[model samples]
Target: MRRVSEANGLRIWVDGDLRDEATRVDAVARFQTLLGILRAWRSEAGELRDEQRAGLGEGPVCDEAGNQFLSIGPVRTYTTFGGEIEWFAECTRRGVGMSQHLRNALWLNGRLNRTAADFYMIHEYAGVEFGGSLGIRDKLKLSTNSQGRLTRAANNLSPLEGGRHAKQSGEAGMTLDEQRTYVADLLRRWINLHSAA
Candidate 1:
């Protein structure tokens, strides 16, 4: 079989040697089966995307120890979102660069929130080096393509982003919170598998 084209965000493949009517019919049947599977997957992924997006807008979530974090707040100079320059100045005054400050903040957030410290540290460092959350995502998305699946299904999937930048670089692209979520998800799945066993 060979991939022919991308049909409606899904890869369409054509089977080899369609000289006979039986072979043609079988190929059509297989294509239809694949279409059904794709449709089902699309539906499920759509639902999951909705849920994930909704979760993103949620209020400050508390950790297992009832410690709240992950929200922007007022600072002496400005609000959390507006205090970028002020924060930079403060960090500089404290003999810490912006990158180091971000690492410290992310690490503190991770520890207080009972999250993955290493993932947050890496993600924040990458974000500082790049630009913003989108930059982090662009850099970390490469992890998904490590195996290099040349299919629309893999391309259109979550975390893939299907952008040209994802191809330009091979960095571990992920946002700080996304990295923590990814780490937690891995541990969760591992526990589930182990618990069932």
Candidate 2:
């Protein structure tokens, strides 16, 4: 628990986890008192700004296009007392449907960056179920070989020659150019969804 004296002569009390009954009741009473004080104070709505409401160090984010894109902060990973990994965030927003889209994008990016298992899973699903296109099943198979090994050899040797290798390997059913076009379309759609007004 923590308490501080505000410049306006208001006592600010921040209580930690209130386990005991007494602490809980006292915290509730303190919150009620604070609420009453705030309600009693009258202020002009115009005096408040969006940045102020968003608190300190919060504002518009920039994307690759250098546009002011609204984004939820990156997801935070923490280890709990029980030795389990978890994520936590307290998100507040002003724009319509902002939180939903921002959160979805942030969560997806975080999962991809941290684990990448979801990425492989989704890629497999795309190859098997949707044929790698948005909704076109082009008969792309993503399962392992008969020996339960990845069909495509892990060719991290030459990124410049990746397309040729993929074509020669015959693992990726679509040509490199076709794959690039498909990915470009997908990225365009994703950017549109995230940057929609």
Candidate 3:
């Protein structure tokens, strides 16, 4: 049996049979990575509370018992676009009707900004599902390389912003809001296509 305990706002799993030191270290590393991903999602959702911020303190994260933990800081709110209540309701309805995996992919895509890392993550999560024999790109009339070009452009912008790679010398050819719209449309079409299949 595995015993779970919470510390520094993270769940630590203690397994009795797992005695390998390297495996235990790897499991902790993976758990930390997963925690970071969840924290990023929570930040994107703008759900961080003041108390949580206070608990994080000014330096590295430490529990009340003075046990030092991962260097993760408190999530800060970003300027995310807010839509109408009715539109949000419609989106929620559509998401609720989809399969769990598809819904998660779409949700993560929607929460992302117009950064190269965001584009790459989106592609990794939803692209394969819609690509290949599914013909989603063709149905949307997107060029064979449209997704790739967008991802490259986002990654290769000049004077790199937001800690993403910027080795090229041009813009993404679309504004942030435009990119958001395009991704939203793509996800909507995917949902429609999958539902009909």
Best by the TM-score measure? 3
TM-score of each candidate structure, all chains considered together:
0.21, 0.20, 0.42
lDDT of 3 by residue, 155-193 (tens): 665534322463665556554434445555555555555
lDDT of 3 at 16: 43
Cα RMSDs of all predictions?
Answer: 22.7, 19.5, 10.8
Per-residue accuracy of model 2 over 73-134 as CA lDDT, tens digit each: 43333323641111111111121135343223223322211122222232343344333442
Candidate 1 has a TM-score of: 0.21
Question: Residue 114 of model 3: what lDDT?
Answer: 33
Candidate ordering by lDDT (highest first): 3, 1, 2
lDDT of each: 0.37, 0.31, 0.48
- Candidate scoring better on lDDT of 1 and 2: 1
The lowest-lDDT stretch of 10 consecutive residues in candidate 2 is 83-92
- Candidate achieving higher TM-score, 1 or 3: 3
